[model samples]
Target: MTAPAKTYTLLDAAGRPYRSTTKGLWGGHRGSRIYGRLDCPTALLALARSTGYAHRRVFFTDEATAAAAGFRPCGACCKDRYRTWKTAQENGERWNP
Candidate 1:
């Protein structure tokens, strides 16, 4: 008999584990310490333009997890949000958005 299928699990923003049936939930860049929506056009364009882009692509279960990992919002797609976060950092305020 065939063995039961194994389920994939990922960490939440709080680092809790949860089952993930499908991938491609969120995208991140390890080099830049940034993350954004999977459908972000800027991220898609960057991925298309680079040869080793796939290696830099990281996935997160949710935005909270991405933020918790110290990933800032993408500047391209999340322009306003990025600006706010940057401003907060510049003013020495804790960023939480």
Candidate 2:
């Protein structure tokens, strides 16, 4: 008998959750709309502090999906990307990545 496949919850470009066989490559926060690496210090700190961060936790397959979902790069983990995103936001330009 074959074992059942394990599925993961991932967010699409529309920020909707779906089941996938592949795990998400990035982590995000639903309320804050911020995405970052799985090892992001800020996110870890929030989680460690028991601040209910887990309830708002989200996952994305890639940066493009996160961006399309209206999420921004995290300043703490994705410094360079955040700088670019911040500049684009300040200039009233759409961030492509």
Candidate 3:
């Protein structure tokens, strides 16, 4: 049997609502990033680590908000979709593709 998901409620930039597992982390350091308090998931951070968009990838205080804002899952630690992303990158489907 699997455990129930934890409840995570928090506010994000633009005053949007969100939820997440463990808190996210910083992708980069910049003053313009109003949501610096926010955090990106480790999985998402991994993707950012292996790509050109490293600077853009980061933790958001509210994860659901990040996802809704167009942020995708991180590929590195996220084993499930890692391969999917690897294939995409190889085929040039999402490498700034």
Best candidate, lDDT-wise? 2
What TM value does model 1 have?
0.74
- Deviating ranges (above 4 Å) for candidate 2: none
Tell me each candidate's TM-score: 0.74, 0.96, 0.29
lDDT comparing candidate 3 with the true structure: 0.44
Residue range 3-87, candidate 3, lDDT tens digits = 9887544435444446776554423222232222224355345456666555443455543454344443444333444465468
**Candidate 2 clashes between residue pairs 3 or more apart in a chain or in different chains:** none
After best superposition, candidate 2 residue 67: deviation in angstroms? 0.5
How far is each candidate from the true structure, as Cα RMSD in Å?
A: 3.4, 0.9, 11.0
Model 2 lDDT tens row, 32-90: 99999999999999999977899999999999999999999999999999999999999
Candidate with better TM-score, 2 vs 3: 2
The candidate with the higher lDDT, 1 or 2, is: 2
The model with the greatest TM-score is 2
Model 1 error, position 20 (Å) = 3.8
Ranking by lDDT: 2, 1, 3
Q: What alpha-carbon RMSD in Å does predicted model 3 have with respect to the real structure?
A: 11.0
